[model samples]
Target: MSFRVLRCLFQSTVSLTLLTLAIAPNSSMAQSLPYLEDPPPPPSRTSQRVRRSNPELDEYTLGPGDLVQIEIFEAPEYSGEAQVLANGMMDLPIGGRVYVEGLTIPQATDIIAAEYVRIFRYPLVSVRLSGPRPLQVTIDGEVTQPGAYVMEIPLKAQSGLQRGLQYPTVPELIELAGGVTLSADLRRVEVRRNSGNGKEPSFYIDLLSYIQSGRRGQDITLRDGDALFIPTAERIEEERVRQLAATNFAVAEDSPRSVVVVGAVNQPGNYVLIGGPSRSELRPGGLPTLTFALEQAGGIVTNADVRQVEIRRITQTGGEQIIIANLWEFLQTGDFENDPILQNGDTIVVPRTDAIDSAEVAQLANASFSASIVVYVVGEVNKAPSIRTLEVPTNTTLNQAILQAGGFTDDANRDEVDFIRLNPDGTVRQETIELDFARGIDEFENPLLRPNDIIVISRSGLARVTDTLETIFSPAPEINSFMRILETLGIVGD
Candidate 1:
């Protein structure tokens, strides 16, 4: 072979080798391979933004049952309303399915606008919360009603506009849940606000300060999805003192102190005495005398055993010291020293006979003083209703109560009348009293009637038997009357 032919062949072989190097399957390192793993997702906005500053958007987060409207400016075909599904996504006409659950109004607008730019030159998109879900709040601990409450706000449309939200205050919500219990610790209340990212920021509130001074900044306005937790009080006495202080009472200062009057007194309630140096200033006619205390309690009744009148005083260490007074002896002998002087927080109890229960001493700390006592007169009373419940003067006697109840009927067994008394220990005491119409004032057998006394001027046995037989055989509408008669006569409880 000639040299030129050999060179040409060599060039052809070299060209073919170069072409093979260029086209025969590029190197695995030079060309990209099919990825077995998923590509990295775009950076999420939730991961980048730590906090959002929109007040209206932060007030309520997108959740199930929330209705929203998306508007694309000048593009009516794509603008429509979409409810957030339970999965937190909504399907739009062109944007398809998009997640807006944790996104605020502004963030949702940005995401929806980004998707619409492919369809329009300038997508002037806007997202609006047309209808919000029900306003719900969680109240935990020491409140009377602790649970989730749905706020019923009337969204009355005014001038073709819906009413704005009336965000409930901490106190109002507490009241709506039946108010805070007495054991609640108001010093440090917790309020947690949702940030829509599984993170809840909390703040402390001093409810006691607001209740005491009506302070402006202490009670904050609560938003939807907010939670309030009132803690339990450690010391109930201290909280009670604070409660009294909040009521404008001078519990610790020079204000008047109240004393409770209970038992057989006419009025069973509290009477106030001037505090400080004037506490001992029981004038010739003032509210500091044992007699004055009795008067404030509606006076001692005829049934009250004056020899056993007790004055219970609470010591500084919460101990009780009781002093018994024999006012009957003092009245008979005309002695002033027997009538003792009353102090602040003293309780005067005029017990009936010897039935006083020592257990009531503990209740004296919170005994309420009412202006009048209620007594029931039944059976043979002249009142049209047959049973009369009367709010009579404190310390009223049986005869006076009967007179107040329109006196007894002709068939009333006055000598065998039943006087039922309810003791503080919840046991009932009943006695049969004999009353002589001609008896003198000193010889009167009528006993004093205390609060909740039941006086039964029952008819004679003949009348009761006649009524019972009439009820069983009359086939009349007065069957209830016959049953009641039987019940009153201790016959048929069935």
Candidate 2:
């Protein structure tokens, strides 16, 4: 019972009381606990995004091969479904034959249901589509894949042949066929369909317009067995014009006794020499002269050297004669005698001028400076090859050398041709030339030809591998004749 012991006990009691007060839960904490009697209500259905059950579809038109179902709840025996016939008419019980050709499924169903109400009392009718409705069309011509395609939307008489189809556009159809190749024309397209009277109606559609402009509504809708034809491009039309022109020129030039002047002239090809008393005294009346031939070939492309002119003549006595004439001297003195008349099969070569030689050397030097100069020629002519180095003569135009090796084959593009000119400074220039043979009088005066120019004569629209092979083999007769001559000379075994 000492005073110190009593004080220690009192202090320990006070500490225990403080510890119990800190650990005990208060009334506010107990009140915050969730009540078992009122658990959280099930999650509200409106909290999540709503999902649509059915997707929106475009309106449909009923046609033949479409199956429609009809049901009458009040009078089951009075209603029955039927398929539309080829005539676009469908027969229903108590509804008779109703034309549903141009009507949508809903529209056709309402018509049939209205017809049934007249027969049955308190009639409750419903129509449902049971089978696929197929709309057929035919595709022909230049499409990569041509065939009949099914139309997703049934078309009425007012619907275009272009719009009712699945593709909905000409460009889409073109894309469906794996896109246009190099040969596709795209300009001229024809849609052929049969009229109700059993006659076929042809509709011309320009795909180029539709593609250039996003006009899907203008496309023709395809129908079953409808034929679509895609023709070639405008380039082919130019070729046709050229061919016609060339043919006419050939006929006109061949009609008169023409002189064949070969070799180097500004324009060294063929010429028709006019004969007269005044000009005849210089040489035989109708013989074409080198000057005349050069005039015809466009005055000898730029670098023709007038200093040295060589003429080769094959004589009748099996003698080969050579003549050298100076055109520069003839020009200065106006000597018609020295300007010899060119005979048939005569070759007159105009040597290159010093300017041309210097230009060629400069070109070579420029080519060597860059070390990346090449030229290539493709299409129609013989020796379609590529060349390197810049030593080609500046005056050597495409026309001069195209026939020098061998002329164009049958499939050569005569009219619309492309020239890809590559400059030494890594620049490219493209020029389109018109080679119309029929209008020879106009075009022959100035034939555009340049060296290092690639003249591409596109393949004919109708050209096929078989046609190319036939063209290649067409020279068999000429080859056989040459072989016979060689055998006569005891050169080789026949």
Candidate 3:
């Protein structure tokens, strides 16, 4: 259903009534329900003093902190107002102390009326309840706070039909405990309820159905002492996570999460990731994604295996779980699941591939997770600085790096550059390459540069002779001091 339709359904009295009946414990239409599909007939709305369900825990009754007004039609002296004490006893005119806690209004009124029979031959009694005690429920797994929560009876209802009678539902219970984590799987929320027998029975609910489609019976109306557990999803997809995050069920944006990003990244270390901006107020940024971690760690290296990226997480259920992020597949098919959002304490590992394709490097260099790389451009370009360091994107070519550093100066050797690249095995590959911008990019031409590659743009023969003469006339100390001054001014970039 569209959001508008879902909101409208949640606002209707008929919807609440149907939801209540359809999810009744014994009703066959529990979690398997496609729709309301012949919901049980609504219970008669006669003055039954709020006996909504037959189950002991599900029944609504007077409790401690309740205010009750008792009336006797025939005998005015026997009528009075009483607040139930902590011990669940109320002081009445005739009954003196009657235990009314956990009893329906009419049930307690009858007990009080029987006590008044001694004062009058024919005694009629009525008891009204107000300020019903808050419902106490326990929530565990995937919620911000997984413990007992006291929820005030909310006044807002679709209509007054369910206005005074609506108890807290599963959604309200979740909100009470704080929003769910990114790992929460709303598809199979287990609500453990008192079966009235010795054993507590659990019912699995697809809460997303109710949230998205306004399906009846999916969002169980919680009762006092109900326990809800939101299990973590085994796997995730981007769109599904985004859909839930847009709702209040997901964590809020701007939340800071500390994480460790290691393996095959330029800067492999700890990082603090901030939640992305709210997609909109209605759809908060929700949670930081794996790409957010990559961005924080200075991007993946050229040999990174995007297909086998791993996120090691400490699950809400108290064990570690490893989830794979197939970014290569995501790149191919636009699957958001390949780049799932993250929770706190996640360790993202972008493993290295044994064999990397050049095309893959080109593709990932343009990915959002790509960060800058440092390359030394010495003996090059501008006359003022003979040596300069340029921080450019990974896979930036020799030509691109040169252009970014203001290109070569007028005296620079136009035909060739000395390229020195460092190998991971602690060896250097040095070569003098001929420059031809028109020939396009290739291994022998404008090859893609790696981290810490060195490029030398030697001066032309005439410029070299002029520099030799200048060096002969000038002292080495003065030139060294001038270079030192530039360093002090922070003009020679790193």
TM-scores, all candidates, are 0.41, 0.30, 0.71
How many clashes show up per model? Answer: 11, 18, 3
* Candidate 1 local Cα displacement, residue 471, angstroms: 45
The lDDT of each candidate is 0.63, 0.50, 0.73
Error of 1 at 397 (Å): 13
lDDT of 2 by residue, 1-494 (tens): 99999999999998986575456423223212223554333223101111212111124566788776676554567657699899989999765778987676556656675555344322345665555465566555544456666655433322321122232444445445533322345556777776655799987876555544645433455554566666544232323322222221111211222455444342456555553334442222333455655555544434455567676655322345566776656655766544665434556666665344434322332321112212344667655442212223333344544555356677776666677765436899777766654332222222333445565666666675556456445555774866655554568785
Model 1, range 1-494, lDDT digits (tens) per residue? 99999999999998986576457323432122222454423334211212334454444567766777777655678889888888998777775878888676667777776666445433566676677666689998766458998864333333332234445678767767765544566789899988667899999998777666756332377866899998766544433433523332113234344778888766678877552433343332332457656655555554566678887766433346676777766666756445665546778887876443222322221222223568899988888899899986544567777888998787777676778888768999887778655542221266555678898888977777787667556554674867765665678777
Off by over 4 Å in 1: 1-54, 58-60, 93-95, 152-166, 197-201, 215-219, 235-494
True-structure Cα RMSD, model 2:
31.5
All candidates: CA RMSD (Å): 19.7, 31.5, 18.5
Compute the lDDT for candidate 2.
0.50
- On TM-score, the leading prediction is 3
Position 2, candidate 2: lDDT: 100
In the range 1-494, model 3's lDDT, one tens digit per residue, is 69999878778977776677656632433322333344333222111122232232224577787777676654466667788899989888665788887787657866676555444433445665545667778999988779998877643443322325457778777776778877788899999986544678898988777757745342368876678999988865557777777776566666667889999888899887667655542222546778767877878877788889999988788767788889888878977788888777889988887675667778878887877789988885873477888888776778888888888888889899999999778999999998887765466678777788999988889997787567555656865866654554567853
TM-score of 1: 0.41
